[model samples]
Target chain A: MPGDDGLRSRFPISFRFLDRSRTVAPPGWSRWLVPPAALSVHLAIGQAYAWSVFKPPLESALGLSGTASALPFQLGIVMLGLSAAFGGTLVERNGPRWAMFVSMTCFSSGFLLSALGVATRQYWLVVLGYGFVGGIGLGIGYISPVSTLIKWFPDRPGMATGIAIMGFGGGALIASPWSAAMLESFGAGAGGIATTFLVHGVIYALFMSMGVLLVRVPPDGWLPRGWTPARAAVRPLVTTADVSARNAIRTPQFWCLWVVLCCNVTAGIGILEKAAPMIRDFFAGTATPVAAGAAAGFVALLSLANMTGRIVWSSTSDLIGRKNVYRLYLGAGALLYLAIALAGDASKPLFIVAALGILSFYGGGFATVPAYLKDLFGTYQVGAIHGRLLTAWSTAGVLGPLIVNAVADAQEAAGRSGPALYTTSLYIMIALLVGGFTANELIRPVHPRFHEPAAGAPAAGRPLTTEGRQS
Target chain B: MTTEDPAATGPHPTGETTGETTGRTAGGGRAVLMAVGWTWVGVPFAYGVWELVRKVAQLFAG
Candidate 1:
């Protein structure tokens, strides 16, 4: 009878190996193992960046328009936001292993479905499979390792997250060339595209499985060697108190962060979405006109900047504090936009340097926000709160392209050429950065009302169950 | 499950279990895992960056 009570107390449900309870690190499990586990899922899902490599082939092979070819990518982005927001609480409840498993399933299956669609010449199926199903994988996979890494490496949340996020940014670097090679070898026809998709699905599934298997929740009271609560709370914004994701949405600080993320992303994405053509247009009339190949190079350079900034600037946040790092992102970002606007193509070096600076801040902004969320809100439901905050990214995804594309179109219609076409958009981006800077200034800590009482006291936010302690 | 296990304690309280005290698994396998984990993600990432740097060189060469 006592054994039965002990057994019931140890594991509420029959001890399944895959349970969140089972995933708890067995004392000596090296915390170093966690980041790579996080990176596995992130790197695999980050292939979302290479969606463009499929576009041209898909359009030609399927006899679709440019806009139609783009539907899958757009829907995927939208789903990334939606699934992250809605699935966040569940992710927090289920633990990283479960989330990673679900992500791998959805993501890999998305590729398989796309293969079927391509083989059958059903374009709509491609949209449904790659855009919707694969997108859920992207969303869930994106946040899976976030809070776990924070728990394991509270001393270096910024750096830990930056490492995994950098994987996402760099994913395209691998997928782009790899997919191109596959298309080249596979013939770029429907059959070839289908084979490529099939291969991609199988490969990514194998890759992401590493994360699902390797990820572990830290023990309830585990702290890094020499790290303590007082040490972590030395920062002005870093809170020792916890905030539930449900309560986080109600706070003004959350909205302020939302504005900051949306604005920073909008400014950066506007330039990124049109990086290749923008550089060419900027120098079209100059003595040194940028060639098409050079423009492609510029886009590649921006990708490098974007990828590196996630690690570099986000790691910098650890020493400088999240607020100060963001000050650099917004304030310096605004100044860079101003420099680009004023310098124009008068100096190619100035233009390239300024764009790179702006892009670094953009990638830094994405990589650092999770740490920022952990700072303002506590680690309790930080992943869930992070998931909800991604809605800002979705909003900016639409807003950024619209502002840049629309302004350029209007300028072209009005007989503008070269730098003239983008001048208004640049200025508009500068204004948005200024607004984001103001929002960054406005972010105060979440109020006590929003804070989830620590495990023992009357459950303030949610029930203080196993899920509550899992964080 | 009862909330009594030190493992089930609330989100990070002050120092309860430091990494030094928690018996570390000392073996070749743990070392191997650490190496393999980093290598698995590291190789592909390095390849990606190398490919990108080549393209980046083209931009500067122009």
Candidate 2:
């Protein structure tokens, strides 16, 4: 009876049971071990961002239209959201090790399938393989380390999550140049692309295996050195009660954040998907003709900005607070997009700076949201909630490209040129950013109805009569 | 008896609880494996990407 009471006392909320049952590391083990475990998975699956590097080759080799070539990347994004949302609860139940292992399998297999598709000239296979299967990996791998890292570094959740999230951004830095070289060596034809896919499958599988093997949950009753519940308890960001993943979806905060994330992503990805073409169009009539290689470099530079922003801006959130940081991202991001629209390609420097700024905020939005969720929903079932929220991302993945591409394609058909094509699209992104900013402003403290009462309290004020006890 | 005294407990006389020891070892193993494993995993991935880039450049040049 005492042992049962002790265990119950240790976890005031049902969701905290997951945290309570964890296995804590020994005294001698360094905390530094956590990042690599995170990086291993992140670095491998982060290849999703680098898909653009393959766009040129795929376009030339398959003789596919631009929109046609984008299907794989766009669909992969769609799948990433779907898989993450659907798999989140399972991920939380099974633990990071299980989730990451599954991620590695799906992602690598996706590559293998895509390789076969390319070899056989079956374009649909590439979409099914990379977009559907590999996307499942992206979603799972993305969230696998989140709950674990938050648990391991409760004292510094933002910093811990930032380190792992940074890998997602940095993944492209390595993948871009490497993918280009693979295309060069093997030839960018179907055969060459196939070989590259084969290499990606084998390499990422091996890399991600490290994360699967190394991940561990902290032991019950273990707190980070020099920290306590009492200290963490007072912060407005800390949640004393746990919300089940199911009840979490019912909360207004969840939907509000969902809208925020979706709109923010839509705005950023609009420019990103069309960065190369947009740059060329912006400078076409000007004396300064943007060369193809230079435009490619511009895309690469935007990628660097995106990746670095994940680390720099998100880590900065720990100091300024999540809501405040997002204010900068959404608010300033709208202004930047407006600048690009209004500047009319007259000032190349302004265009580049604005584009980079928007991309940075885009990447920062991803890296910061996990920590933001931690602040709102207690870590009890955060991975699951994070997963559900990713449905928004899936929506944006499709929506962003469609808006940019459809608008541009339409404009081209209408015989527009020299910055005219993207003007309407830029305005749309600005509008989405404005909508996101409004949602961020609307986020209020979660109603008490959502909180699970502390253990031993009479459940009089229970939020939902049925799930209230569980919350 | 003092709450701190393991001998005073009515259960097994062993000084250490099974949970305590198991937790320690498992945590330690995970830490070591994670650090060393990531290094091993990262190296090959880095090399693979490097190889891909080298090849792509060659294709363009030749």
Highest lDDT against the true fold, candidate: 1
Report lDDT (Cα) of residue A457, candidate 1. Answer: 76
Candidate 1 has which clashing residue pairs, if any?
Answer: none
Positional deviation of residue A185's Cα in model 2 after best superposition, in angstroms:
3.6
User: A360, model 1: CA deviation in Å?
Assistant: 0.4
- Please count the clashing residue pairs in each candidate, in the order shown: 0, 13
Residue runs of model 2 more than 4 Å from their true location after superposition: A1-24, A52-72, A116-127, A186-193, A229-237, A413-415, A453-460, A463-471, B1-62
Docking class of 1: acceptable
Q: What tens-digit string does per-residue lDDT give for candidate 1 at A103-171?
A: 999999999999999999998999999999999999999999998999887888999899999999978
Native contacts retained per candidate?
0.42, 0.04
Q: After superposition, how far is residue A17 of candidate 2 from its true place, in Å?
A: 20
Q: What TM-score does candidate 2 reach?
A: 0.81
Question: Chain B TM per candidate, please?
Answer: 0.57, 0.45
Worst 10 residues of 2 chain A by lDDT: A1-10
Model 2 per-residue lDDT at B37:
64
Model 1 complex DockQ against the native: 0.26
